[model samples]
Target: MHQPGTVSSSLHEHVQIGDTLLISAPAGMFTLDTTRTNPVAFIAGGIGLTPLLSMLQTVVKQQPERSAQLVYAVRDHHFHAFAEELQQLAAQNPAISHTIFYENGTEEDIEQKHCDYVGRITEAWLQQHIPADAEVYVCGPRPFMQAMISILLRKGITMENIHYEVFGPALAFSVD
Candidate 1:
C-alpha cells in the first residue's frame, strides 16, 4: 500500500467522493460469528481498521452484552483513522471498547486520552489488556500482523481462537 504505483496507493490518494466505482460482491475467508457471546479482541493497524468497524456497529445494536475490544495502531495521534466513529460506537455500546497504539506518538495528550494508548503495543501490553481466553481477530500490514500472531501463539492462544482475513493475494491478518 505504501508503494506509489500500486492500485491501493492510487485509490488512497486519488479517489474522490461521488465518483462511481466498480466493485465485486463481498468476499472474505473470515467473518464475525454474531451469535457468539464470548470476549473478542480486534487488532488493526493504520488503514486496516476498515473491516472491523461494521462488525463493531452490529455488536452495538444487536449484542450490547458481547464483550469486545479494538486495538488500532497508527503512525501518530494526528494520523489515527476512525477514532471518532469507533469511540462513539464504544460509548453507545457498553460492551465495546477501543484502544489506539501510536508508534511515533507523543505523551498522553487529547488524542491519546480518547483511545487509551500512546505507544507501541507489546506482548506485555496485550497480556494486560486482551483476555487470555478471548477470540482475537487481527487485520493490518503484513509484518505487523505476523508479529502479533507470533505473540498470540507464544501466549498460548490456539489457532482456532485467532481469525484473520487474507487481503488480495497476500496472507492478511490483524494486529498492529
Candidate 2:
C-alpha cells in the first residue's frame, strides 16, 4: 500500500534484468477483490497498466470466473506495451474483455475486432461499455484519472465502487 501524501519516484522505477524487465511488486491501493462476483471494469492509461496487469495475472491464476472489462488508452500502438500478452489473456479467459483506445490509431491497426476505440474515453463511452453496477478501477495520469472519476460521478457510480491508483509523484493539475 502507498503512503498517502508521500510521493516516491522509485516506486515507478523499471530495470532491465537480463532478458526481462524486473518490475517491483505493484505498490498501489487498488487490488483485485476476489470475494465479489460482480462485473468489474478497469481503466488504465500508459504505464499505469502495470498494476492492472498484475491484477489480471492474479485473477487468471486464482479467480478466473470474475467478469472484467479493461479499457486501456495509449498514444499509439507502438507505445502500447504488453499488447500481445493482454490480447492472449483476454482470449484465454472467457470472463475477461479487453479494449484499447489509441489516440493515433485506426480500426484496421488493432488485432482484436471491435476492441479498439479511437481517442480518449469519455463518460458517455464508459456508460456505453461498462455496466451500471460494476466495480471500477482506474489508474493513470492525474488528468486522465480525474476525468474518468468525474465521468463516473456524473453517471451515478457510488464513490465506494470507484477506486484509483496513482503512480510516481502526485501530479498537481490546475482545474481552473
Candidate 3:
C-alpha cells in the first residue's frame, strides 16, 4: 500500500545536485524523535544530509527543548549539499548550532572570522565540537562513518548514545 505524503513508485526519484541527477529516497528505517530533549550532535558528509533533513524538520515542528550541534563535512562549498537550508534552519532554531568543515581548505581559511572548521572530522575535531555526554548521530560515507566511530570509541563514548546510517551497498570482504 502507498502511504500518504510518500511516493509509491518502484522507480526512485532523481534528486538533482547542480547538473548531476541521482536516484534517491525509497524508504528508510530512521525517523525523528519529536520528543527528545537531550543535547544532540549530528555529523554529516556529502549527500548524507537527506535523512538529517527529515530529523531537523521534525524537530522544528515538535520544538523539542534541547540543544543541537550539527557538524557537516564536505569537499568544498560548491559541492556541499543543502547549505542554504541548513543555514535557514540554524537561523530559525535558537537551540541549533552548526559547524562546517571543508577538507579542501587550509586551516587558516577555516579558522577565519566567517568560516567554521577546516579539514576532515578528526578525533580532535569531534572532541571540540561534541559534548562529552551528548547523544551523537553520524551519517556519511562508509569510511567517514568508520572514522567517526573510531574516534568515538577512543573518546569513550557509549554505543547507546551513538547512532549512524550508511547509504549505498554494504561493504563485503572476499578471499582471493
Whole-model Cα lDDT of every candidate shown, in order: 0.78, 0.78, 0.71
In candidate 1, clashing pairs total: 3
The TM-score values for the models, in the order shown, are 0.80, 0.76, 0.72
Q: Candidate 1, residues 105-175: lDDT per residue as tens digits?
A: 66665354844566678999888888888888888776777887888877888878888764555443544
Provide the global lDDT of candidate 3 against the true structure.
0.71
Task: Return the candidate ranking by TM-score, descending.
Answer: 1, 2, 3
Tens digit of lDDT per residue, candidate 3, span 1-176? 55532442423454434555456653333555555677777888776767776677666667645788888888876677887888888888898878888888666666552347667878887877688787777787777778887787667788777777756444421211
Give one clash count per candidate, in the order shown.
3, 0, 0
Worst 10 residues of 3 by lDDT: 167-176
lDDT of 1 at 81: 84
Worst 10 residues of 1 by lDDT: 167-176
The per-residue C-alpha lDDT of model 3 at residue 75 equals 82
- Shift of residue 13 alpha carbon in model 3, Å: 14
Q: Give the top-scoring candidate (TM-score).
A: 1
Residue pairs clashing in model 2 are none
Runs in model 1 deviating more than 4 A are 1-6, 11-28, 108-115, 170-176
Residue pairs with backbone overlap in model 1: 138-173, 138-174, 139-174
